[model samples]
Target: MADYEERVKLVKEQLRLAIYFAREFMDVLGKEKALEIIEKAWIKYGADNWKGRLQGVPPEDILKVMGEWFKAQEKVRSELKVVEATPERLSIEFTRCPQYDVCQEMGVPEICQKYCDSDYGAATLINPKLKMIRDKELAYGADLCNHCWVMEE
Candidate 1:
């Protein structure tokens, strides 16, 4: 039989990999929607882990849940829709610090402890309302779905 310690170690490693995958995809996808997916994964992982700990579910069950999420992500990516982005024309918002968050917005904030302070540009199909831009090459796959962030993969 497999040692419990080794199994636990393996589970941690898998979770790390999943997180890495999520970050990579998020960078290319968008910050808003990507955050949502990551948060969902965490919630799912947490729930499954709890089940294993309290309900005697096997560790493999947790791994399986992670695997399913990854699979679904890949499946969706295979059919992603990339559309040509047109320059945004709406009133755009600018961030106080371009480097803190590193947004293209104008005026560099000294502290940059918060979000943008002004309107530099508007949300566009191309520009997107998302704060982060994933894969400059890929037209647009997913957008930030919450709190002015990313949402794909």
Candidate 2:
């Protein structure tokens, strides 16, 4: 298995390729159309990617599952700080994100928002009764990314 640094390098390379293709699509399809396509594609990808992984998770355990998921990611675990965890809610703060860092380095920081929106799709597929909230993001010039998952009443 690759170490965290190697994994981050691979992720950065993938983001670079994505940025390149996005630019090409924008040149041919126009910026607005390209962005629309990118956003929809990522949303579907996020939903499809997490649906099966979260299939059998009970609504009451959703927050725990999400926390575990983040902990499983080496890079995310390094930057993730769990602010609170309970049966009703889980709040986390991430001081850094490789995707946001790469996007900023590439001079297309706004592109990170399209990728960030994928979490909404993931949350919906995970469980309709669960709500995912993100009020701040490093990708959007915030000091940290604050994420909360709550079991809706």
Candidate 3:
């Protein structure tokens, strides 16, 4: 939908700004502080964003809802492979990431690590009964990013 496209654009813009700010911060403060600030900010944002997106959605259906969103995202932009999806589990492999795309475009590719780390906090907010595991990320020069979510007892 057009709305989703707009949302994608907005996310891209936000990422660009974040990378710019991180560069600026690194120049003034240092790499450690810059990474810290960006990671902290995005973690908080991810938690809040996923919390709001999952609001009113039941635990059993959270992955379903997210799966639809994820599928839509692949359609809109980004190269994503849906590895598996079920009520109890979901997995996706991302070969192309918008953040990585932005980083490459801006020549600040390392910023993707800070952005990718937000998924950890976001997963916590999604559901305490759910566990999210990501072993590799494109930002870290991995061939692909694998995200797996499982429902826990």
Instruction: Give the alpha carbon lDDT tens digit for every residue of 57-149 in model 3.
Output: 888898898887777776755567788878778899987676677777787776778878878766776677778899999999899999998
Question: Which is the winner by TM-score between candidate 1 and candidate 3?
Answer: 3
The order of the candidates by lDDT, greatest first, is 3, 2, 1
How does residue 30 of candidate 1 score in lDDT? 78
Colliding residue pairs in candidate 2:
none
Residue 74 accuracy (lDDT) in model 3: 66
- Between prediction 1 and prediction 3, the one with superior lDDT is 3
Stretches > 4 Å off in candidate 3: 1-12
Sequence-dependent TM-score of model 3: 0.82
Q: What digit string (tens of lDDT, one per residue) describes model 2 on residues 112-151?
A: 7788876776677667877789989888789999988888
Q: Stretches of candidate 2 above 4 Å error?
A: 1-7, 72-76
Q: Give the better candidate number (1 or 2) by lDDT.
A: 2
Q: How close is candidate 1 to the true structure, as a TM-score?
A: 0.28
Error of 3 at 140 (Å): 1.1
lDDT of 1 at 55: 55
Which 10 residues in a row give candidate 2 its minimum summed lDDT? 69-78
Q: Give the per-residue Cα lDDT of candidate 3 at 59.
A: 85
Per-candidate local distance difference test: 0.33, 0.78, 0.79
